[model samples]
Target: MSFAERYGPWAVIAGASEGTGREFARQIAAQGLNCILIARREGPLKELAEQIRAESGVECVTASVDLAKPDAAEQIAAVAGDREVGLYVNNAGADPNGKRFLDNDLQNWVDLAQRNVMTTLKTAYLFAGPMRARGRGGVLLVNSGACYGGSSFMATYSASKAFDLCFAEGLWAELRNHGVDVLSLVLGQTDTPAYRTLLAEKGLPLPTNWASPVEVAKVGLAQLPHGPVYNWGQTNDVAGYAPNSPDQRRARVLMIEQHSRSTFGDD
Candidate 1:
């Protein structure tokens, strides 16, 4: 099936308060679908839901959740209840305390993993079974450009995203013939409150060169059911993705490491 046909007009987005998640909500609403918004901050989620309802006339449901505690995943998965979930956009994510690995709070690292990976996994595991039973479903996992070689200061965040990227692909392969379209979006730096907080924590002095959430959401929505992972549009991304062979991929990894050091190192 085509991309549009695969996704239809329904979506559920986590981290829906700001950034790519919010953009996804808007775009999907415009696509003429109802939406479910999940995030810890209910105020913004409610505001966005109201905006989408008023502007796009799409039904919006808000679930204020901190998907980091034990059993949080199961609780989140239970929301679907009797409804068949058509599109699951796992956009919820968190960064570690922004300290170095040695200085970072262990609990923060654990929270990052639970929120970013565990929650997405639970939702997919629970909802996909039903969607597959119905012979249709689309899963959108929001990964990051930081998941490349490795991350230094933001090690936990990067590792969690890597899990997201890999899991999306593996699951997609399993569900393809079953009409399940699983997608992993490898997003670059985006202009959002979360990104701002992270940059401030990292003390990056350089000017921002980032992509918009709208662009990320649009490209992601266009590419699912075809494969697992896709890098969003950005001119510089060409150089990063050009590497194909295993050796070349290694070279690419090294390059990412070098650039990351330069970009994040104290000047």
Candidate 2:
């Protein structure tokens, strides 16, 4: 069956204004799915909706709302409103508090938790039920390499991604038999506007090997059938356990700490 027949008619992409989320919307629309694009920026979302409609001739709806808001999931659901949303991509997240744990304000951390953790949980709860009831759907959770271990200056960010990783893994097991596919897309540095801006702001150079958002989206979509977890460009087992032995995990943590100090000037 074609992708649309199997998992679509409609797909919802959170964070769809740009980068990987935008790429996902484009690719999914190309697969013949109508798209509901949700993001904080109305301008970019509308532009992307227009582009997708023009390019793919697929119906597109743009929802402009901050996913950090407590009622974001309900707002997205309202926009989707009875559409057979066969695929939902939870891709909206960021580390707003870039300072060290103690240096960051408590409210910043709370906001991060609400956006990264609470939003994902609530959105999944709202969307997954219908997908399961229909018995044909997909959920893709965009996670990061920071999920592999603790990140020094990015402690909360990493922890939130870890939650996503674990959540998707559990859902994969629970949903596989229900005709629902769940995938945790574990990504390394991807070349995106936000990431470039972040590097520029910190005076850090972009890595030559950073994955493109388009490539990441393509790989992630293609690997949905192989999940539980899909580590971009990696063939090794990435399920369960930290991708390292205990000693290696310790070494990796130290390396991350040193990198954090060098990058952020944190102790």
Candidate 3:
């Protein structure tokens, strides 16, 4: 069966204004699923919608709203209207300033938590219900390798990603019997605009292992049937690492500290 037929006729891609999210919107539209693109930036979202409509001839709706807002999920649902949204790509996430935990103000941490954790939770809760009722659907939660363990300069960011990783895994188990495929998309360094800007700001070179957003999106979508968890580029052996071992944990912390200092000049 075609992807649209198997899942549903429509897919909602959060954070679809640029980068991997844009690639997801394009690819899903190519697969014949109408797309609802959500992002904070209206210009980019409208441009992407136009491009998708022009290229794939698929219907596209753009929602301009900050996912960090508590009611983002409801707003997205309202834009989706009565469409059978079969696939939801929860790609929107907060980017933390690469600074020590104490360096950031309390409100910054709160905002990051809301964007990364609360919004994702709300989106899943709102979308998954309809998917379950329909008996066939998919949810892709975009996570990061930072989820493996505590990151020194990225403590809260990593914690939020860990939440996403666990949430997706648990949902996969619970929803499998209901014919809803849930995937935790564990990404390594990707060559996205935001990542590039970060590198430039830090005066660091791009990592050789960086995957293109297009490649990541392609692999992620194709591997939906194989999930619970899919790690993009396999850059980190997250599954093989023994986090509980004292020696390994110590080594991991040392590595993170050294890398953080070297890359971001964080002590």
The order of the candidates by TM-score, greatest first, is 2, 3, 1
Indicate whether candidate 2 or candidate 3 has the larger lDDT: 2
How does model 2 fare in lDDT? Answer: 0.84
Superposed Cα deviation of residue 171, candidate 1 (Å): 0.4
Model 1, 85-158: lDDT tens per residue?
Answer: 68888887756376777797788888888888777788888778877877887888888776665666778887
Which runs of model 1 end up more than 4 angstroms from their true locations?
Answer: 1-5, 201-206, 234-267
The best candidate by TM-score is 2
lDDT accuracy of residue 9 in candidate 2:
91
lDDT ranking from best candidate downward = 2, 3, 1
Q: Please give me the total number of clashing residue pairs in predicted model 3.
A: 0
Instruction: Give each prediction's root-mean-square deviation over alpha carbons.
Output: 9.1, 9.8, 10.0
Candidate 2 lDDT, 63-153, residue by residue in tens: 8988888999999999999898999998888674567988978878877778889999998888889888888899999988788888788
Better of 1 and 3 by TM-score: 3
lDDT of 1 at 162: 79
Off by over 4 Å in 2: 236-267
117 in model 3: Cα distance from truth in Å? Answer: 0.9
Worst ten-residue run, lDDT, model 3? 241-250
